[model samples]
Target chain A: MLTNEILQQRLTEKFGELVYNFEQPYGMLTFVTDRDNNLKVMNFLKESEDLGFTFLNDLTAVHYPDQLGKELAVVYMLQNIQAGLRIRFKVFTDITHPDVFTATGIFETANWLEREAYDFFGVNFVGHPNLIRIMNVEEMDYHPLRKEYPLEDQTRIDKDDDMFGR
Target chain B: MSQKQNIQLPEGSLGKQTTTLNLGPTHPATHGVFQNILEMDGERIIDAVPTIGFIHRAFEKIAEHRPYYQITPLTDRLNYCSSPINNMGWHMTVEKLIHAELPKRVEYLRVIIMELSRIADHLVCNSVIGVDTGAFTGFIYVFELRELIYEIFEEVCGSRLTTNIGRIGGFERNFSELAFQKINHFLSVFPKAMKEFETLFNRNRIFMERTMGVGGIAAERALNYGFTGPNLRATGIDYDIRTAHPYSGYQDFDFSVPVGTTGDVYDRYLVRNAEIWESISIITQAVKKIKELDPSVFHADIPDFYLPEKADVYTKMEALIYHFKIVMGETAIPAGEVYHSVEGGNGELGFYLISDGGRSPYRLHFRRPCFIYYQAYPEIIKGSMLSDAVVTMSSLNLIAGEIDA
Candidate 1:
């Protein structure tokens, strides 16, 4: 049984100020790291015998247009199957250069997941072997899931934005 | 008939013998709208590259704009074979965010519905594998059972295929007497049908020869690919989400997670078949447990989120106000991040929601399990005979809706 506290303590001790915003929202440990240290933190979590979160449960990105320089938050959900524990970590990068180190080398599941994140949020995954669009057409010019993009078609004149509470 | 003799071949014809075969975006064997570019040498596949996204509807993008309650219908479209599980999973994610305490009856009712849908899903998967392996009788046989399961869902929620069955806290209405009757009838009839279905293929020499050693994946490699549910269980890892992290009172029920050694096409089939039995056992336990609880209790008592009765709305001012608030999507949602996963038909289907104290989620991502399995398809099917690829795919149970979502 690896409790959140023990895992938090180990992460803080090793990474120190490099990791911050340690929160246990809904009893799942969450923290933030510098975009540069994303792979380092993930590698440490996987290789460390005490905190073996070997399973990459999910990988996706959340875009916050209001936050400058930290617009995109690439979230990774990791799980330790034996202990039945899960932890989430975020690495924030700017929209202009949304480059985060890829975890495809560590977990093979990250290959297509990283492609999905890149396809939706335009997050350039550094060092991913084949980071082409997986869910969208290659000819698509813009990422569709960003907050700025409207859900409805722009050219549709019959429906008003006010009706949708936009 | 006249050109019986062999003509002179080009010098490089023997060297470059492999042919490129485009399997589908519409092929009957593919079963879904996804294309596979296979490099084949005669009947054996040398390499495969799958191209997906034919049915991508951008649900994640749409989810960010819709009110939380309205998102249930969108979840229904994913894995349509077992949509009740997806619906319940979405509701549970929101419930986790709001911290709603469900009654025992609601939990047990949910368990029954979810397990029934699991049976429906696995029945489709296993029977389709049989169909691919040249046994069509089992497919026709179990489909009647699937219709029976759908009839039970119709009794509960008035819809069958794209059910959108339950609300955030619990079901829209209490389970009717007919629903329970149908469940009992199916329970009594399903085992015999399933046993017959199994008897047809489980010991047959042809079925065994086709699937026994085909499309095998090591346990370590399956884990590395983030495989879950029966596919991972087929690789001998008993990491079931129901046991690992119990949800919807799954801990109250007694069931077993069946595992296999080789993780091949046959192992996947066996795992799914065994899971159907386990789901039946779970539903049986839930029905028994529900008998001890109050029959009238269905949805939880969360006035803010749950819609009020139409009759009450017409008579009472409080009911009308709550009705208006919920219908207008004006209920307050707290700012937080929550990730909830349910063991879906295929694997661990997760909902990661980030709400900013708004009417809708600020960002919502569905951790679709089929998406993960599809990426591993090319590797799993490589070096296998063309006929074996079809069996491997059906056994994996890849749903294009879930994959491209």
Candidate 2:
């Protein structure tokens, strides 16, 4: 059945304490590891015939400005085709030097997915071949999705409080 | 004179003249705002690079600030070809995080609406493939049925292109008798027109020659590239989100997933054509299921999130208070993360959401299937003829809104 218990057991047995913080919020298993071993764990999960989570459903990152030291977290969502099982794994890196190894070698789809993570959250995938500003223009010199930046457009300063009866 | 000059030509001009063709950040053939810089040696494309994000609205950045309900309109712009699926997917993700319990009637209603939009989306994709191959008649014929689908959307949501139709709990209101009538009418009339449209191109010699072996991708390679929905099914893997995950009570109804073996343009077209039939069948079953249930049931009973009736809001105090609170986005949602995927027109449209017990989402990332699968375009179209590249792009059904988002 490839239940959460089975997957978690395999993950923990393979990595010991290297993989930790397991949680299942909505019937899907999620856990965390350090940025250094992110690629290794992902490759092992993909290559292991028993685990065969070959499909990379989603790859993105979440930024936590308040969390000291490890301010950036990259999330990888993988799915097993036969069992229709999905599991999420995250790796946390220091925002100042966010250099997680790239998973493009393991999953071909991760090439652009990692670039998007880098483009928005500034989580530099160390071995990315062509990491550049993908969604944003080249002239813009900031990672916009970081919590440090405000969501609303800052350049439009003309709309004062009185302008809209706010 | 010409022979001597050609032999002693400058270094820059001495190489074979390979034309650099920019086939749209603006061309009509791209269907949407996409630019593929194709390096061509005569008619054959040597290399191609696709540049997207021209219409990038920073949806992820914009989503973080908006409250959960306000984000439906944003999702409407994701795959505008099938916006309701995106809206419903977003709602389901939030519902998963908050543990919203839905009713049986609500699930069947969603199935109906979602399958209708899937048909609408495939109508454009398959017919446009025909248009790219110089068979414009099918596109013209099939698009009339898209109007019928839009009519159903208009009756349900009051909007057409970007219908913010479904609510977090369910629909904002019950389906009108007119909406049911229109859907029934569409169900009866569409298949005949669809058959006529199919007869025009299904066995046409020209379409077969243009699409048969062009832009072929292997099953293994497609999965490695994260292909989903019809594109993945075209590679013969039957890995449908509705069948695999069975979200929105898909297990109640019965429909088979149509798959193809060759993973070529013709195979993709065939898969989409068969899927339109499957969607119609699914919708018919969903309507029957909805009919068997009580007519009064629509949205789930989530009093805090779902809005009260307008009459009740005007007449009663508690209803008014709940109305004001929900409308003002003061409902207390949980702090957690959830990812939900729906079978969108293009492929698997996923919404990954994180909430921090605030009115707004802390982080929202849309796993746009087109954005992920479009990465394999240059690889698929490489070493193909220019005309074949156009046909290949149409067959892939790349929507700009979803791709850039």
Candidate topping TM-score: 2
**Local accuracy of candidate 2 as per-residue lDDT tens digits, B1-405:** 123334566667645567899999899998999999889988989898888889999999888888888899999998999998998998888888889989999998899899999999999999999999998899888888999999999999899999999888999888999999999999999999989988998899999999999988999999999999899899999999998998999998888999999899999999999999999999999888888899998888888988888999999999999999987988889898888898899898998888898888899999999999999999999989999999999999999999899
How accurate locally is residue A23 in candidate 1, as Cα lDDT from 0 to 100? 97
**C-alpha lDDT values of all predictions:** 0.93, 0.91
For DockQ, the strongest prediction is: 2
Docking class of 1: high
**Considering every candidate listed, which one attains the maximal lDDT?**
1
Which 10 successive residues of model 1 chain B have the least lDDT summed?
B1-10
Q: Which lDDT tens digits does candidate 1 get at residues B212-301?
A: 999899998998899999999999999998999999999988999999999998999999999999999999988898999899999999
Lowest-sum lDDT 10-residue window in model 2 chain B: B1-10
DockQ values of all predictions: 0.85, 0.87
